[model samples]
Target: MIRVVVVDDQAVVRAGFRTILESEPDIQVVGEAADGADAVSVARRCRPDVVLMDVRMPRVDGITATARLAGPAVVDPLTVLVVTTFDLDQYVFAALRSGASGFMLKDVEPEELVTAVRVVAAGEGLVAPGAMRRLIVEFARVGWPRATGPLPDLTARERETWLLVTRGLSNVEIAAELMVSPSTVKTHVGNLLAKLGCRDRVQAVVLAYERGVVRPGLP
Candidate 1:
C-alpha cells in the first residue's frame, strides 16, 4: 500500500483528499495535519511514502515543511506532492526547490491526484509539461541567477539525455530520438540523476533550468 499524509489548513480540503485517496485500494491515508507545523510532526511519526501538502498553511508553510522533510540535507527524504489552489510560479518554484517531487493544482481531477501520488511514490516527478514550460519562462523572466560554472561531469550521451529529460521527453521518446533501446535510455537517466544529485526527473529539470543548461521554448 502507498501510505500518504494529507496536510492542509482547511478541514474540508483535508477530508476531501482523504476520501478520494482512501477510495483507492493501493493507497491509504496514514495521517492528516491542519497546518505546516503539525504536518512535520505527523509526517515524522507516520513516515508516509507520499505527502499531499498545501502551500499556504500557517505556522510553517508547505515550502518550508517540504524543505525540512525532503531537502538535500535529509538522509532519507519523503516524497512530497504539493497541491495548492494557486498556479503561481513562485509557489511552484519554491516547492520544487524545497525537494517536492510533484506539484498539482487543487482543482486537479481525483484520478489525476491518485496517479500523481503513485508516480511520486514510485520515485518520479509529476509536474505537467505545460506547468514546467511556464516555470522555465517565469525563471527566465525573473532573471533567476544561479551559479553557472562547470556542470557536474557528465558524458556526452548523458548530457544529451539530460537535455531531453528537461524537454519533457519520456524514456521511449528519448530512445527513439537517440536511436537507442529504452533500457539504454533508462540507464542514462539513472546516471544523470546520480551525478546531478537529483531526487527525480523533476529536480533534474529544475536544476537544468537553474543552471541555464536548458531554456524555455528552445530546441
Candidate 2:
C-alpha cells in the first residue's frame, strides 16, 4: 500500500482527501495534520510515501514545511505534493524549488488527486503539459539572470539529454526520442544535474529556461 499523509488547515479538506484516498485499495492515509508543523512531525514519524500539503497554513505554511521535509537540505527527503487553493505563480515556483514532487489545485478532481499521489509515490511526478506551459511562461517572465552562458561542463550526450528534459519529456520518452535506453537517459540526467547544480528535474527545467537554451513556446 502507498502510505499517504494529508496536511490541510481545514478539517473538512483533510477528511475529504482521506475519504477519496481510502477508496483506493492501494492507498492508505497514514496520518493527517492541520498545520505544517504537525505535518512535518507526523510525516517523519509515519514515513509516508506521499504528503498532500496546503500552501497556506496558520503556522510554518506548506512552502516552509515542504522545504524542511523534502528540500535538498534534507538527508532523506520525502515526496511532497503541494495542493493549494491559490494558483499564484509564486507558490508554484517556490514549491518546486523547495523540492515538492508535484503541484495541484485544491479543486482538482478527486480522481486526479489520487492519481497524482500515486505518481509521486512511484518517484514519477505529474508535471502535466498545461502545468509545464505555465511554469515556462512564468519563469520566462522573471528571466533567471544567473543562468547565462553555455554549460561548458556538460558532455554532448548530457546536452542532448538536457534538451529533452527542458522539453518536459520523461526519462522513458527521452530514451525513445534519443533511441537510447532508459538507463542511459537516467545516467545523462544525473550527469546534467551534477553539472548544472540542479536539485531535480524542476530545477533543471528552470535552469534551461534562464540560460535561453529552451525558450518558451518551443515545440
Considering every candidate listed, which one attains the maximal TM-score? 1
- Candidate 2's TM-score reads 0.80
Model 1, 1-219: lDDT tens per residue? 999999999999999999999999999999999988999899999999999999998889999999999998999888999998765778878888889998888887899899989989999887766566767777667766475766789999999999988877778989999999999999999999999988799899888877888775566
**Which segments of model 1 are wrong by more than 4 Å?**
none
Candidate 2, superposed: residue stretches over 4 Å from native: 145-157, 171-200, 210-212, 215-219
Cα-based TM-score, every candidate: 0.91, 0.80
Best by lDDT: 1
Per-residue C-alpha lDDT of model 2 across residues 1-219, encoded as one tens digit per residue: 999999999999999999999999999999999998999999999999999999988878899999999998899999998887656777776877788987777777889888889878877655554567776676568654445566657778898898888766888999999999999898898878888877667678766766788786565
TM-score, predicted candidate 1 vs. hidden true structure? 0.91
